[model samples]
Target: QGKNKKVIILCSVLAVVVLAVVAYMIFKPEEKLAVSTVEVTKQTINETLDTTGTVSTASEQSFTLMNKVKVKTVNVKEGDVVKAGDVLATFDVSSLETALNEKENNYEKALAAYNKAKNSSSSASGKISSTKKQIAELEKEIETLKAKTSTTKPSSTKSDSGVKVSDDLVKRFIKIAKRFGVEYDEATARRVLTSILSAGSSTSDISGLLDNLGTIAGGSGSFDMSAFAQMSGGSSALINAEMSLVQLKAQLATLELQSNDTYLSVYKTVYENAQSEYQKALTQTNEMKKGWIASEKGLVSEVNIKVGETVETQTVVDGKDVDISSIISSISSGIDVSKMISSFFGSDKVGIKVLNYPLVADISLSKYDVLDVSVNQEVSVKSANNEIHEGRVSYVGAVATSTGSSLDLNSIMSGGGSSSTIPAQVTIEDGDKSFIVGTDVDISIITDTQENALVVPVEAIIIDGSDVYVYAYNKDKSTAVKKKVTLGISNDTYYQVLSGVSEGDVLIKNTSGLEDGAKVKLK
Candidate 1:
């Protein structure tokens, strides 16, 4: 019985010990977690706007030629320096020479035609003047005869049979008789004859007076019988003289009309022909001076054409063909070929090389941040080589890039894809020629800076909307108290403390699972 009892006691003791161990394992407080913490510190903080861009050369050039003719001689090679009046190349002039010769012949022909037309016009003008004078003289002579026939009266001798007029008397009497009532016989006839002799009547007025006289003589009227008989006999004679004058006047008028018509025709034709010829000659001369064969003076740096090489007419510039002669002459002179090329091609001096720098971290910055970014701010450029370079903020696009849809392969292929970030230009300031234009580079532009500023590790601060909170650890590390803080500029790993947390305050570096009022133990 004693031995059994002792064994029971040993078992009981083992059960109690086992129970105590289990209780200790189940109820022991959790060992305090050893958390890393940082103390608020005073330091300088720099806020930067980071992006990427490329580098490019400042100057470049290109050239083009205009002449399509076979190259005869190339005077200069590429990169040759030439001066003004240098011949760069030459084209076969055989064709141009032939054309010029043909133009010269045409010009000579035109000139001859012009001279002949001019002479004919001048001769016609002289004949017109002579004909006009002859007409005037004939008119004057007719007027003189008319005046004599009008006033002269015939002498009559009285015989057994009334007044016996002599033939001369009869002729004179007939001339006067013809005037009779038609020409105012004695009184008006004498006045009209005197007016004509005195040049008192205009040619038109004189002709009208003659017509009136003829009408009067031809009409019947009362007068002295013998006188009337004598007048009647003279009437036929005066009428004949007047009719002859009329015929002569009509002939003179016809001659004047014919001469005028001939003169006008000749003058117009000749003048027109001469003008046309002169214009043609002038045009030909100008063309010869300005055409392909015309020699020019200029510097030519590059000559693409070789001897006997056929080339198409190249547009050297936007709308102007290359002046073949000028180019050839320029090439002969050692001028800068690059400048010539640039001028010919109408290209920008600097060639842009676009590089694809893939986007890393893009975020919409607030309007307040946008205003801080400006041109020429020094920044850090991170290249593909993992090298950092100094850069400047070259541009900041005003408009934001649009982004709302999923990736569109078509848009990407067509280079029409959109994004949310604003476009900006950064120029690499530090780097050798190894940096190419349009190369994508990472850039960080310093937007703000503060010296000896109150700062804390970025991990220490918790951002919730606009409100920033930090967990402040007690000196004993028994608890972490949540404290609100106002912040300033922030860099990659640190934040500038504007208010709240001060130096010497221990701040929690990691706040992943911490709550606003969570209790904590320090290890």
Candidate 2:
């Protein structure tokens, strides 16, 4: 009976245990991850940056006139395409003629002054150089005289010696004459004395003139020849003094003549100064009139002036103000680029704009992309119509520029806070023969290229601090295996796997919640 009861209990326990196992099996399930996968392939991987840019052929052509003048006739209007050297308008030169005439008048005036400054040919013809030297010496002497005058005022013209015609006496007389605005050489002074002696008929005329000659000695003090006569003691003494007076009068005449002759040199100097002034005025005016006119094969973009319109002393044209002073110095081409019309009679007042064709594609790139780009690197441009043109990098900016497209580094890289870019240009091969002018297109610059490289989707790559990894799917284990990787070049879509990942490896595309060993079901 006991053995039979134990057997029943064991059977009941076995059944309960079986029921518990079945319940647990029904409720509990194995964990798995739903993931996407990409095949690692070996192919040529091209590292490229995608960017947008405007396709432009050439810059706008401008034509303008710089000077202020009247328009005589209008030869062309806007939208008229003309060849180089074509006359588009004529100007009224009346104002220009007047200006030239004024300048010429100034020049003539200077010449007239210069001519007048010429020392009288008859007066100082042979003594021109000597006369100039003499004048300079006199100027120094006059300065010395001024210094002397500052110390003392001359009280009298009397020499240390009595009124005798000696060297000292003559010197004193000359000093006195200079004070009175008369001077003479020694030879001339002696001739004057001899002439005075010859002219005097008697002492009576000499005596008569003595009272009138009170101021003749020219110092602060007056000389009275009458006093000399009184000193002579009697009639014979008076006669002697009268004879000396005649000699003095002759010397004074000679001194007066010498002093008057020096003025011719001063006139010559004044004329020379005037001549220089006139020449400068003439040169400046003539240079301003030698205006530059524009000539090129271009269309007449716009016309600002009408026939017979007098150019304002200052006027605004094409949003720019024109002025005479500034125009004279900086306008070497003689064209104010803002305005299209020039003015001058018999001179062409029209300006023709210049334009050229551009044979290159201009693009802008982000800083990272530009770092790998260099001049002469190969580039390929694709048009909207899928037309491709091969070219090379003609230029690459060394520094970044703000004039880049709105979409930049931020668009490609998450957490990329920068949008700064660098500008680049590419010259199309075959002279743009396959492309139309002003066509918008996509440009790809080849930064790095690899052949038969293992490439995988960029999404497959994962990052942990100081560790780069990818969730590589192992077919045998039916699991995603996190494998550290070394990477090379990359583009928008894929990365060139250098190592730690191999060709034919299935890479997990969705790395969310993935770790080193995770069970994954790839669909």
Candidate 3:
């Protein structure tokens, strides 16, 4: 009975204690809590693409040397202003001097040969003149003899037998005598009767001759008897004289022809040959002299060999020696110096210049974000040093590359495939030399903005995908109500409200412990 009474007393005491605790929980007044609220705001938002690139220069030039000779001097340094005809370097000319001497000796030999050929021609011409004068004197003597012989002869037409007078011959003699002007017309009749008895022609033949006399007399009008006698008497003497003159003239002509063939023709050949040889020698000498002068003038810009360095006259292209002056001219004039120097020296110079200010940056963007980037767009860059610069986007690569692969969620979340990009040129309106090229930077592009925006804290709004809701506190600060809200542009900290929320409303921010229409205390 005592045990039972103890258990019963314990149970009654526990019940009274629980009832007192429940009465205290149910009857206690709610305490007032201070809470902060934000009104819904409307604003603008922006989307942009970001990329990076490096800067480079505009122009450059390089110089190289041609021949392998000692470096006599380097007239121009890297930054020197070299004109077209500037004296750059010089080489020893002792070898060219020896070549010039040999050419001069050859020219002298040609001149001597030409002089010898000229003298031989003058001697032959004098001999030909003297021979022609002798022939002219002989022809004059023959003419005088022919005149005397023709005057002494009178009708002396006998054969080589030299038979004398017959009556027929006497008659012909009288005719010849009259025709030869040896007798007058009256003397002719007496000479004819005398010739008839002397030549012993019959009377009948004499009568025939008299009958034909009229026919023969027809040609007697212009006849000169003395000239005919002279012609008959001197015919052989005149022929002999003409033959002698012809022989002398032929000898003189032959001598002149031989002189022309031997001296004029041969000497002309020799003179032409000598002139050609002398011209060749003079050309070689002039070349050597010019080469020496060029070496002295320091026109050769560079030489690879030392003072005792041995080098062959190497054929640059199929037996052509290197022309040092042409190379120097090409280099000084900015011609094809690279190819010329390369052919001579077997190497080329690479020249590059960095003209514009260059800035390099590494940037990453999403495929959807690539469209907003382009060349020459203004960008706000924040450097690693926390310094900010205003620049224009100069370039954006069309392809995307990986940043890195990592096991972290943030790294995996950033991993992506190929993303299209636009390169933009950004000109820094203010030149800032402190920003070094190749520096990585953070960029944000402002796509949109709004003034006097009615905004609320992002945390105060509840978002289930696209559906958004907010817990509005009632006037009593207890019993908060859930209200659906229309939203607008948003940033990291604030959300723009388009509708369903107004100014001065106390919206619930931490709705984790609250239910729809549930009693809520603001703190």
Candidate 4:
């Protein structure tokens, strides 16, 4: 009976404790939840496309030697940084000086021979004077003949083959015909030229003539030269006069040559040949004396030959001729032809490779990522060593390369097949020679950016279906107020609030236990 009484008292104590706890939860003052808050403020946000790339030199140039000479000094070694106008190597001038002396002596001998021939020809002045008088008489006779023909025949200006072609129009027709690879003899030329000129410059007429000409030049078509000639309307009188004039002009040219001392041309040719030889030797000697000069600033990537080595000439011999006029013109136009001349002239080919700076990183992007990348976009590059550098997007290729499969955009997006990639490049703005080429690097391209943007932490955002809101802390009511926000571009940690939030607005950092209109206290 005592044990039962004790058990009852213990149960009564437990009931009293449970009743007290329930009363306290139901009747005590409402507890305010402790919450951490953040203030929205203006900040810069950058949306980037992270990728991998390889370090590469922006440009590479190769220099070569163009002479067979003994190298006296080697001024640069591989991996040396050099500047424009720096002498890369020197050559022994002993052999060149001897050659230059020999050239000067030959020139002097040729000049003496030319002067002697010229003096001897001066003694024939009497014969030259007679020839000049004869030429003048012939010119007068040709003029009289032309006058007589013009008076006798009013149509003397037209062709005798019934073709009416002005000399200028004939010239123009010949030019156009040449473009189509067609030509005609003297007589046939006149008729065809006259027909084309008579036809107007309308599209149909010109195109038809071109088509017919193309047929004559081995193209596909049935073109009849006789039919083309039949279209000419010219008189015979004018052609006869023109033929007579041509004969007279030919005779006059012979007389004029005689009157000007014909032997003078022969001697002049010899003298000019000597002069050309001398000039060529001089140009080569001067260049040899200068050795090899750096055309522009670059890092030397190769040094193929050592000092004291004789590089043999590889240029064309007398049997093989090369057109060097264009090469000379290239040099005159400020193009770096030091290396080009070496290759062209078959000179002793010692290549000096140069890597030009501001460095660039080569990377490839998937088809979708390429759309967001463009030239001039800001970028950040990180090397394996944790070194960071600023850069800009320098190039984005338009074409995509397949990776074992071809798929359309819709199919690729829906996971139908493998995607293609496009090549891209970034120019490191602050890059220099210190940046190693062919190294791997990490890059982030800032595809989008916003400055002075109203932003809040992503933790403060509350997303429900299509609605985006944030729990803003109300200082007046000591509660959390739900406010809708229009979002813009976002970075990793913050969202750019385009609307519904102002700078300096307080927001709940996390909405885990917070509800709209819930009482809250700053933690």
**lDDT (10s digit) by residue, model 4, range 28-122:** 97678899999999989988898888988878766555355577888888878888888887878778776556556656766776676566456
- Please name the candidate that would achieve the greatest lDDT relative to the true structure: 4
Query: What's the candidate order when arranged by decreasing lDDT?
Result: 4, 2, 1, 3
Model 4 root-mean-square deviation: 16.1
Any idea how many clashes model 1 has?
A: 34
Model 1 Cα lDDT, one tens digit per residue, 35-90:
57888888878898654444443323222222333456655654344433444455
- Displacement of the residue 505 alpha carbon in candidate 1, Å: 2.8
TM-score of 1: 0.38
Q: Please, what's the RMSD in Å of model 3?
A: 32.0
lDDT of each: 0.50, 0.55, 0.48, 0.66
Which of candidates 1 and 4 reaches a greater lDDT? 4
| Runs of candidate 4 exceeding 4 Å displacement | 1-19, 27-37, 66-297, 307-351, 362-374, 396-411, 414-424, 459-465, 473-482, 509-523
**Residue 112 miss distance in model 4 (angstroms):** 25
Clashes of each: 34, 7, 32, 9
Q: Which candidate is the best by TM-score?
A: 4
Query: Model 3 scores what on Cα lDDT?
Result: 0.48
Per-residue CA lDDT of model 3 for 270-380, tens digit only, reads 334434434453453443233222221111223333444333443223111333224433443667644543453222211111113334454555455556556666566
State how far residue 176 of model 2 sits from its true place (Å).
Answer: 33
TM-score of 4: 0.48
TM-scores for all candidates: the values are 0.38, 0.39, 0.36, 0.48
